[model samples]
Target: MPWTLPSRPSRRSLLAGAAGVAGAALLTGCSDDRPAGGESGIPLERRMREAAVRDSARLLERYDATAADHPALAARLAPLRAAVAAHSAALALPPAGSRSPSASPTGGTGAAAPSAGGEPVPPKPAEALTALADAERSLSEARTIDLAGAPGELARMLASVAACGAVHAYLLTSTPGATS
Candidate 1:
């Protein structure tokens, strides 16, 4: 006779399903219906903090890649990269998986980007340090306003991350081998 158990799920199946849902939620948090522009009447400061995470992740990749290309800049950049990575982790932002635009010489639009092979592009450096600088400033300015009414620790963390962004901007701007 075949050995048969109850039809109900065993402990493992229930745990597995819960784990799968949790993983999916983690991966898809960006689309959580948080309105953009604070157009939802949400304050701009809240928006700035969220934007900082996304911008930081993208810039971290670009700077890290560009720094990698120039041997001299790489050592100086290690700490900066580590700081960005830490900030990204704190914000629960995804890591930058895309290759640098410099890597392929295919222009700033790397194969990783969705655009087609040929397109006239602006003169912006493939490295995103400049954009990071802008985002940092925006967040810093927003922090002055009475936004994010509660969650003190989170607000403080965002402020600290914004400061890190300022430092990053200074390093990227003044450091040798940083692209225009």
Candidate 2:
């Protein structure tokens, strides 16, 4: 037979082989044995949950401080404050003993500290209410974003909390007594 050269591999064949190698690497590279929110790493879900919990605690603290500074507004703020407290409690991490290493400390869950020696004079009722409404609006917006990344149960809980915050914002801004 006359001398003949072997045909070279086509571009399509080369690409197919490359793809198969990449797929196999991906399949074997991931390890499911790592603990959830453990030393190896904190999953995205845990990070989002922790952030939500921290934000809820901060909101509760702010409400408490504002109420303390303006005792006259406490009655009007009670419902909103209670709502924030409920959200904080719901999102709070388990106790330190049972929590993972990646979990945030529970210190944020405590009562608001007095400002320095004594409480400063509070802002005007209208200003304070406006500030609270703004904060609630922000929190609600944040929760809405976090909901996208959360697990099914967490997403539902976050949706409920976001709705509560939005309602709280509306009520705070519109209530006749609060604007005074």
Candidate 3:
């Protein structure tokens, strides 16, 4: 007797087999052995938000110190300082029922005033602006890295913040009166 080739599978049979495999995978994937809660169950997002708040506050303090040391640059630096304040406020807001973790107190108004014990003051307006621009650039770069692991909503927010930081750096460096 001659051996005959096996017949091709019908489309319906192929589809049924695929569905059965998928169903089995779905059931197994839902097993209770998976870890619960967010990254390591400690909420990495919350920690990221808190760090953003603290960094923003520190940037604001630095701006204040720079402004106080070079009163001539106060008018020019005001808008940048205001932007940092806004970022700080946004980051400081905790999720429902959660309080913002305490960051270093930004001192009081004029708390960062240039004095013997205060933050070191840059000798020139250009130097201060350069420092601020550098800082903004650094934060923008960090946010780019952070976006990878953040949830959808938080990733969007981080992207926006990163864009804002880049804009701030550009403005600081390209302003008409800014020194080369």
Best by lDDT: 2
Decide which is better by TM-score, 1 or 2.
2
- Alpha carbon lDDT of residue 115, candidate 3? 32
lDDT string, candidate 1, 68-159, tens digits: 45555566667877787677556542223523343322222332232233222223443444544454455445542312331344455665
Report the Cα lDDT for candidate 2: 0.70
Please count the clashing residue pairs in each candidate, in the order shown: 0, 0, 0
What lDDT is obtained when candidate 3 is compared to the true structure? Answer: 0.68
User: Against the hidden reference, what TM-scores do the models get?
Assistant: 0.42, 0.62, 0.62
Rank by lDDT, highest first.
Answer: 2, 3, 1
Residue 126 in candidate 1 has what lDDT? 32
| Cα RMSD, each candidate | 18.4, 13.2, 12.5
lDDT scores in order: 0.52, 0.70, 0.68
Shift of residue 55 alpha carbon in model 3, Å: 1.2
Q: After superposition, how far is residue 117 of candidate 3 from its true place, in Å?
A: 12
Candidate 1, position 84, lDDT: 72
